[model samples]
Target: MPGSASPHVLLAGVDDATEAVLRTELGGRAAVRRLPSGEAVPPDAADEPTLLVVGADVPAPAGLVSALQTRTRHLAVIVVTGRAGADDTSALSLLAPAERLAYVRADDPDGLARAARSMLDRLALQHAYRTAQAAAQRRLLAGGEVARQPGEQLFGPLYHQVLIGAVAVDAAGRVIAWNRKAADILSLRNDAAGRSFPLLFPPHVRGDLREHLARAALVPSPPTLFERLGDDGAAQTLRMSAQAVTNPDGTTHTLVILEDITSSTETRRQLAERTSHALLSGDVAAAMTAGDPLRQRLQRSAQAVVDRLGVAVARIWTLDAQENTLVLQAAAGPHGHLDGGPSRIRVGDPGVGLIAAERKPHLTNAVTDDRYADDQDWIRREGMAAFAGYPLINDGELMGVMALFSRRPLPETAFESLAGIAGQIAVGISQDRLLDRLRATTEALQRPLLPPDLPTLPGLDIVARYRAQGDSLDIGGDFYDVFPLPDGQWALTLGDVCGKGPTAAAVTGLVRHTLWTAAQQDPDPAHVLPSVHRALLRENSPFCTLVYALLDPSDTPVRLRVTSAGHPAPLLRRRGGRTRLLEEHGPLLGAFRATGHPVQSTVLHPGDSLILYTDGFTEGSGAHLSREPEDLAALLASWTGPSDDRLADRLADLLFTDAVTRWAGRLRDDLALVAISAHP
Candidate 1:
């Protein structure tokens, strides 16, 4: 025998020479066993045979060839035939019924050796193919069974099929079940199912597993990808996804899927470290400039990260507090339109799919995968190939999300860098909110220091009002002053500085204090106007209008001397219900250095009223007036009652309420009103 392993040859003829030749070729390949022409084959030999050689020249019974062929069906059969046409053709027809059979010529020694080698090669290939197929079928069956079983019974077969070590442990760290794969890896074969997981794993990993398991048991939807230790002493990365599986009896169990992703975990850790370093290199301080410059810097930072990291698209979404939606703040990419065109996403909806709805990080490597089948339309519309979203949480609240998109699928490791970037964005948003609150507080504190109260004078009912223009951060420049002069007469003035806010407010204070002080020295309105004008001109300021007046109630005409410094004309309402615009005025203050312009005089009878106001009141394009002078005159003329609290209230309503309605609830300038009326 060629190999002496096992030789089972079926010899049809009793020729010694032919048998010896066949025996020589199969010597070591198999244990050469012979079969007679009329002898029945052993049943065991029929199922398992190393070799089978048949002689072609021997004639057999009618059913002999069919019977022998059936017996040796499982064995390899070789036919030794003559080179003649009839023998060759007949042997070929008989060979069709037998598998693992080859024909060789009787005179050919090389052909027999070649035939043996060929049959052996075919057997080896068939064995390998069967082995692989059997293994695959076993895995498939095991996986299907695990998938169908209750959660408590699923862990064992799943780990075995995946060839990954796994053990299901309860919250108390006791193992409920362990798979064969775990036994192979950990070298623990006996009683592993009921043992404590902590005894098998390291203390730290055991603690982590218990903590994660506890959380999963309590939460409605648990987090996945928890890290755990492997059987090997070295750190073996694991991803644990848990689902709450409830039985028919209402008993709940945590179905944990354990995946060994050591290489992927290490990649994520390294990438996160590199991303942190890269983000630290960004000029965060420089990016937080004021106004449009700040927006530009922020855009550039986002663009730089996208470019350096090879992200197909990057976007920043900010929370709109009023609208209660997340609006796209900035985005950059070739398909950046995904973030454009009403980029507001409702918090409760599945904006960009479930990622925004859950207010947590969502990652998908394949947009067309079964997990994203429900959101395929949205993904296709956005041209999304792969997506990752991380919530931008500030103070534990979801402010928005920072998302990255790619045309090609990215590994899970890519999201760690983006999550870190989202954290940074959250910090920035929190800081901005803090600054805005501080600014509002500062503005509120400054409001009390403005024009506090109007002074009270005998024989005159006076009303003063100051209102800030539309929700602006700046303080107003309007001021009203009432002080008693040395002559027992009251000097009153109302004026508006050219601008609004702190600078204008400062100028208003200066002009008000100067007028009060100048009026005390010279009770005449004309003299007070020139002194204040010269003081303002010395400061090299622009022109400001003022109406300064001295009122003496004891006099017959109520002795009023009024001076105008480029101010609106005062309205005079008589007791008979007649009103006129007092246009007698001088140049505005700060126009020249005390030009000696004379003061204009106007008399007020008892039961008459005088009104002084800034341009804000008359500038209103209301139905009452088309211009400042006309608005003032018409308002005064309409008052039928005595000028008392009711009249003052009416004046305030006309200026503020009526004008706001006319201007569509917006104010273009600060408004100030001062009303003085003679008592009956």
Candidate 2:
């Protein structure tokens, strides 16, 4: 009724004056036109709507109504009568009975207009309803036949093809008659007359079924469910109802109907499980976006697995890079026996090792404990009947392991769910392990060689790693330090002294201490560095190459304002894998009485990487390292570990392990590396 278009209305047997009145009363919404007597509606307008307003005094009014209805059911007829014709029954008797019949008194001023508008409105509503019904049927059946209404012509021959089965049994529990649906569903002969009803029922429900039948004669009641063995020998749920009827001979008889609902019920159950699995997956995905600590995030995910999937002892194990063993990252369960157990499990089978070695998931029954006995004897003693283990592998590298155990076997749907959970665990474990290592390195870098271990600034994960190249007794002249400034920004420095030993070390210390003292007065590179340079000039400290950077991530693309003081240009890798060398260099620190270090500005998009290091990375001096910046950029491109995980490790390996080991001669200068990545 509120659609964009209104139905067409063709009015017949009306004078020009009356037609004008009808159109005005109808609000001019629909196309209202009057047709002359004995003239049929056009072919185009016939199927939409043609309202016939016939007067009882008109000639052959009944014939016109009959002809219009035969063309299409879209026609409706309203017969109006003057006061004289209202008393006559001849015209009414000639008309056929239909749902579209209406009557209005010709003497009434607006009766004909009201009837026409009302009839057209009804026609519009019927069209919309029929269209909606057709759309719903098309969606349900896809491409199947939906030309007519459901259960109309299509269901005429499908009485037996329906999923439900039916049969009739006498009061004595003897099957007297059965439909083909029953025979097909139960897998029996169509003419299974005089067969025993109780014999066909599954063994478990026969007793209750007999009791129901015994009570049927005494009580008039609703249908009761009975478990019956299907053709496949599995129990099927069937509803049975009984009624007692008197025969012509004055004897009483019972009629029973059987309907099966096992498949439909099972379908519902599986759908529920899948929906719950999707919800669990959504929660974990949400946690991935959250800023919670890795282990805490993993703990929440593990608990979700246990709660949604009904598994006991959900746990995550990460592969230790040094020992190559699976170490427990998080565990969730109420069982106390697992306390004080080996947090790091040795890499072997019957547990996590088998999942890794086989390169797939494994479902085992630990109760038997023969071929797959767990290394931990406690697991064997628990008698957990079901155990599911999935290897946490990413990009062909084994990151860790995730597993679950239960006292009872899980449903078939749960296995499908476990596969997806395992993949998520792999990503979680890899990312967390990588971040943990990076954080450890970062904290060591943050504290520097200051007053022992200082509490890192809270609420931000900014950390730095300084790796001095030497044994325990030997300390290198290369150094880096970070401290929080007054206005929520971070101040950091990475520098390399000219040479090693006492003079270089003293210069490094003096440079750092002078910078520290200057930082208190002013932490900006332009403000602080000039004072430190003047003091270093007075002290005549050894020359050191350095870069001072201010880190500010509160903008769309994280901003870094850096001033290069004769150090190597820091490399920035964009999120798309391209690299850039920020070449903004000035005189070495303490080289001039008053130095003007040109400030370089850059932004880091999410997932981008920035690395600052000593020249040792490029001029491998004695080693066969890549001396060209282009070669170094190519090497940086090769170390593509999971960006969110192990990116710092990859940077370390490229600048230290891989490049340093390939030196042409011998190592000379100390190396300092600082790497950071932007989060999405």
Candidate 3:
């Protein structure tokens, strides 16, 4: 109803600079009206086909766009903006459906005018189609069978302008008539009239096409099928639907309709691929990071490849450099078993071993037909067709080999994806192997450096927890110790040496032993900390942070002498669940000469607790886990768990769990926490 007359263009907020340009470009093709920014759309504007061009500067442009869309069925909208990236422009662009919306930059007046003219042309086409539909309906109601004609006039203008390809064929499957859309969609050569419809399709599908046409001519509700045409590299998906129609003379013809759905089909396929890649990467990373043996991790990764990629079989092999042989490390799927012969292959052997020898990928879609694989009965039995074998190379060194077998031919694109997946798994395997060695070395060093068990002092309960940075291969230097001193006093120290690896570990040992010896000679932290400071400077070791607390448990409420050197202040949680920081600061040890060591003394009353930790407990990737002192203080005050033997363990667990969650399980530095709670 709206397109029954000439379309109207309503330009709102057209600046003076671009107004004349727009008018000249529009060429008086449509009735144009200039509406000020302050005015609302006219009440009668919705009565005819309308196009609204609103500027981005208009107040509440997104709201206006929504109102215009909902109020009329035949209105198209264009939003002109000074810049594409402006906030208002983005809001207006996304306010309406893409087909009914257009956006043009204000500086490009010609572009805006072109968009307006295009929309107007579309409106005219719709009006013509609607008019023809009404005339056809009228003729049918007036008994038109006696005077009906053939060809374009009989089908009316609507048939020629419609989007889908349409063809009319006789019951014998010979093409009688077809719309222009059919000729273009099918890439017809010369003339299509009097041609056999089935012959136009691929030779392989011609017989099936004939059968489908016959079925459609006989059935009232015909079936539809999707056919792929063109070369393999650039194929298109055509959805074909057929229906039987009777002419005025009672002759029946089968009407074939085709709609190109290549874009939508490719979109669905790409979405599936992305989902698969994400799932595969997650699974492989999870398996590699788990506390499992190398073989078990490899097995999990192999199973994931099979499950995610839909491969019939997947196998992994690791190279034994000593023997120059590749051994089957993991296998999954129907034929995935390592107990059989050829579990070990020499580097120069054929098939999987050859891929490793050359350090290149081997992809084939004719595994069962290849002469080299003809001897394998399983390949024939399983009807295996496609094979992809990639050498797992990391940093130019062959780590192993990964191979998969499939019963169907995989597209060329799939081989590229599989190659990339193999490379990812290779990197994961290499990292996991390195982590194994690091774990062994770190565990050995940690066992002696950190006190296996804190000394149990009278009226004093101490617990400490330590975790190296997440996914780190280097040894950490975070250490904690609780040792006894003369005069019934106890020395508790938590420290983080600068840097990592062997140098840091060496400094950690020196600091621990020096603190123990110093506290024995003098139980005061002020004297003990300075002595360790001198020891670090003498060794020329990296600068370190230390928190040393000398506890005299003989008193009713433990008298604590605490000293901090370039360390995070310790939290003092009172008996009533209130927490505060004991702020004592000193220069970093081993970094400067003549540095003062400051000490603060506090009494830990019965039912009170003291928490000492390294900076890693608070600092992490994002703001959520950033070093916020207030957040840490509040967290300590909210603790409701018991302060018993497991008090320190539970506290460390809570803090570490929260840190891991906020940082996404990837800590950038070593984390250590020590909780000392006085027993009632």
Candidate 4:
């Protein structure tokens, strides 16, 4: 016991000789104190060591020590009665159930001091068996150490029922004591006293608990936790820690603290799921939107897929003409010599090429398996354990192949999600290419039917702009023409057929040619319109609506001779911004033979514009479509376009700018706008 630290000790039932001997021999070995009376030591000394020494010189206590021990249930008592065996039963009865009582017979300084040290050492061993107080617990319980009493407690009532679930278990994993929260969290019925630790966790996760317990015992200072499922079938994530403690009889014990983290774990899992769903939705949106061209759009889509699925690389390879080779169109993410790296593969080549050739999707969790043994180098260089490749097709023809690589093993759903996005890419690429072909064909046919450039007529500046309906074949029933007439006069006409596409376009061409040839015979708007209507009377399937006007400067103020074939009336804005409508009414073309398409005349003042437009603007089924006649008149009146060169195109764009009801901003019908402004 040399160099042993001193413990707080209390002495009783001894004369001045014992007190002097204890002070001299036990000096610097223990903190010794004296009680004025053996039966009545201070109430605070009940928790400390109280030794009753009956020396040969000092008379023995007469049942007073037994009275003191009866009052302190947790006290340690010792006797030096100068006798042995059953003779010292009086002192043995004063010890607690788990406490040891020491006895001695010698009365010298060494003998008395040995007796005192033996009693203090037993009490100190009992305190040492307790767990190290948590720093947080010590901060809450006490700061400065106070004098130890016989029964004074350190762990007060303030921390007994704390929120944390605390349990004390033996070295055999049998529970000893647990708080109410531990009972509730583990779904224990009544008491957790005798239940084993393995019963608290599900069978599948018991090994994890065992491992944590073993590791915790090896290094008992710091605590650790493991995840498991509890008896309630819910995901029960418990934080566990164990520290080695000792019982009063020199047996080892374990103290554990369990914190329930089931709610936090569930929250994290749900958050990950929601985030993945949102990212998938965004990827679909980016692919479907027509904000970029086909190559760039497919590139963005592939990148989105790679980022969302946490894959290493993704690429879209389009099939070439011979269908025997695949061409890389877009690539994203990291792959050595793969991202914009000028790499190509034949149709039956390894990886993406084979997928495209067979028009089937391919997925493998282990790329290094026997089937892919030959591709080990490629797979290892990509650093991916899983790979997925999807072939993109439109109708029955293959469009492209999409291949993705991942460093982690992927689930079946990753392949399904990749297939879904591949379909979108296929549609986007096909539609864009089809539109390009349609646009080129439309230009070839439209050049001969529609006017390439308006004829330059003195005293008038004319311009026109056209927009076809939807992404359909660019050819439509809308048409416009401006041609020069005899004697410094100009002729302009705007018209719309009953239907769209090829049949209507044929009628449109017939109408334009008939109007021009009839003008050659007679340059009169009133005379030529009836001839054109008669020419179209035999065609009942496709009819035409038209507004024709002839400008003549024979008199001082120019004259606008206008004729309508069931078309929207033309508006004429004067020099002072006042608008007037030449509202001529006539039967629709092809409706009746020899129809009277009367000419309504209007005089064009200087700095004026004559507006000829189709019904696409007013009759469009959109929120801002202006069906009212006054809306057209107001818009015409506000045009200061007699001097600006971009007047015609600007007015056409404004017509549909506020009325975007279609999903793609395409017009429900074709738009043809032609503006003839009188030069200032």
Q: Work out the TM-score per prediction.
A: 0.39, 0.41, 0.54, 0.57
lDDT of each: 0.63, 0.67, 0.76, 0.67
Per-residue accuracy of model 2 over 1-680 as CA lDDT, tens digit each? 53343455666666566667777876556677666556677666654655667765666666676566555546777777763433443554444345567887777648777787788777777777856654554455554543232222222224334565555557778876555566666676644567778888767777877777776554433678777667777878777776554333355656555677778867887888889999989877766556677778778878888888777688877787688677777777765423224687667645565565676777765445433434346655665678777787877778777777887788766877777777776777677666667656534543444334222432222334455443212446777777667777777778887766556666777888887778777778888778767877888777778888887756757778888888888887876668878887788877776488888888777777777788777765644644866666777776665666445446656666755575534555556677766764
User: Model 3: what TM-score?
Assistant: 0.54
Q: Report the alpha-carbon TM-score of model 4 versus the true structure.
A: 0.57
For model 4, give the RMSD to the true fold.
19.9
lDDT of 1 by residue, 422-444 (tens): 77767777777776775586466
Query: Which one wins on lDDT?
Result: 3
The candidate, 1 or 4, that scores higher on lDDT is 4
User: What TM-score does candidate 1 get on C-alpha atoms?
Assistant: 0.39
lDDT of 2 at 406: 84
Question: Which stretches of model 4 miss by more than 4 angstroms?
Answer: 1-304, 322-327, 334-340, 343-382, 394-396, 411-447, 485-488, 553-557, 592-594, 622-625, 639-667
Assess candidate 2 and give its TM-score to the true structure. Answer: 0.41
Lowest summed-lDDT stretch of 10 residues in model 3?
A: 145-154
lDDT of 3 by residue, 1-680 (tens): 24347666777776776667766766566677787555555667654677888775776667766666544446778888775333665575455557767878877877887888888877677667866766675575466443222334435456755888888888789888776677667765446668898877778878888888886664422335556575344677777878676555457688888887888989998889778868887888788777788799889988998898788888889988899999998899977442233688788677777788888888888874442242467777777788888899888888899888888897776787777767777887788767778878877876778887777767767778787885445678898988888888778889999988888889999998998888889978667878888999899889889988888888979889888898888988887789999886888788888668777889988778889988887775644647765677788789887766555566667777777776765568788889887885
